[model samples]
Target: MKDCEFFFESKENVEQDGRVILDEYRTHLKDKNTREDINDNELLEKCINIVFEHMKYNRVYIYGIGSSSVVAREFKLRFMRLGLDVDYLAESHSIRMNITRVNQESLVIGISVSGKTEEVIEGLREAKEKGAKTIMLSAARVYEYRSYYDELILIGGLKNLAISDKISPQVPALIVVDILYSHYLNYNNDNKKEKLQMTLEHINYELEE
Candidate 1:
């Protein structure tokens, strides 16, 4: 048996069908989870103020590649649902051309899992130069390009598993976006209590099912 297989489980070859959804909650429970060192309230408040600041721009540009792109688009739709102008860039030139068009009143949210993706890093630099405010969503430990952003939202700790299968990374990214959605709602909506209650209901439903 391969070392990875031996290290994880025998069920992988027998029953898992080579697909595993990395159970994020289980991963967290494996360790004594700690809240991120950064102030949660401050991050949420800043994101809200930033959103309000660009309310008139009617265009929020989001750029990310691979799995990050999926997360970015999720946020775009969430914001759009809240009546904000949001766009997700899909192609290379579409993003490059739009960079010149972005204004000081616009916001560009860049998502990079590693915090070092060349395209994402370079894109944020271009957006910043165009006078658009930038926010980075990453769990990156250190990045020299950090100085260019107006806000940094850390998603919490990351875990690497030795399971010998292709587990979907997209789900975890989606969960982080959901967390960000909560922060946005907390900061902006006057009906914050109602919104929080709804979210709690959703979580409970998921747990029960």
Candidate 2:
């Protein structure tokens, strides 16, 4: 048997090991300093306010590559259900091509955990030059690229685990998305709730069909 066989030697041991892994994951998720940093900086509020300000009168584009692209897609879907005109592009070529569609009445959001995704940065740069408002979500503070975006939202919860490839790179971004979705749902409680319900029902109908 291998040296690590003890973990899977029995069903009970496997369950125990699973629980331990889950516990560790929960610990990482509950990072108090990360939560406090977001709260103190009021970045979540700013993100929500930005969405609210733009969703009404402008088109929104979210750009990301690799894992960050998944979070960008999720954000687009969530905001879509809330009746916002939002879309996401994950491919480098597509992002570059889409820059032309961005204009003064546009809000462009870029996601990059490393804070140095060339494609995302370039996309945001072009969008900004076209007079679109830009927001960059990152875990690292890339001050050099500060001029490229209007808002820089730093996401920190899983710490270096994401950078070290120990966990999903999108976890921190997903947490921010969930918080933003919740605030958006509560913004115009009744109207947004109705929109959400309508979307859910439409999805369910399509699934059943």
Best candidate (score: lDDT): 2
Residue pairs of candidate 1 with colliding backbone atoms? none
Task: Provide the lowest-lDDT 10-residue window in model 1.
Answer: 160-169
Model 2, residue 144: distance off in Å is 1.8
TM-score list, all predictions: 0.71, 0.84
Model 2: lDDT of residue 50: 80
Residue-level lDDT of model 2, residues 9-119, one tens digit each, is 676977886897677667766778666644543676777778888878878999999999999999999999989999999999999999888999899999998887899
Question: What C-alpha lDDT values do all the predictions have?
Answer: 0.67, 0.83
Error of 1 at 59 (Å): 1.4
lDDT of 1 at 148: 63
Query: What lDDT does candidate 1 reach at residue 121?
Result: 74
Q: Which runs in model 1 stand beyond 4 Å of their true positions? A: 1-24, 29-34, 37-39, 159-167, 190-209
Q: Count clashing pairs, candidate 2.
A: 0
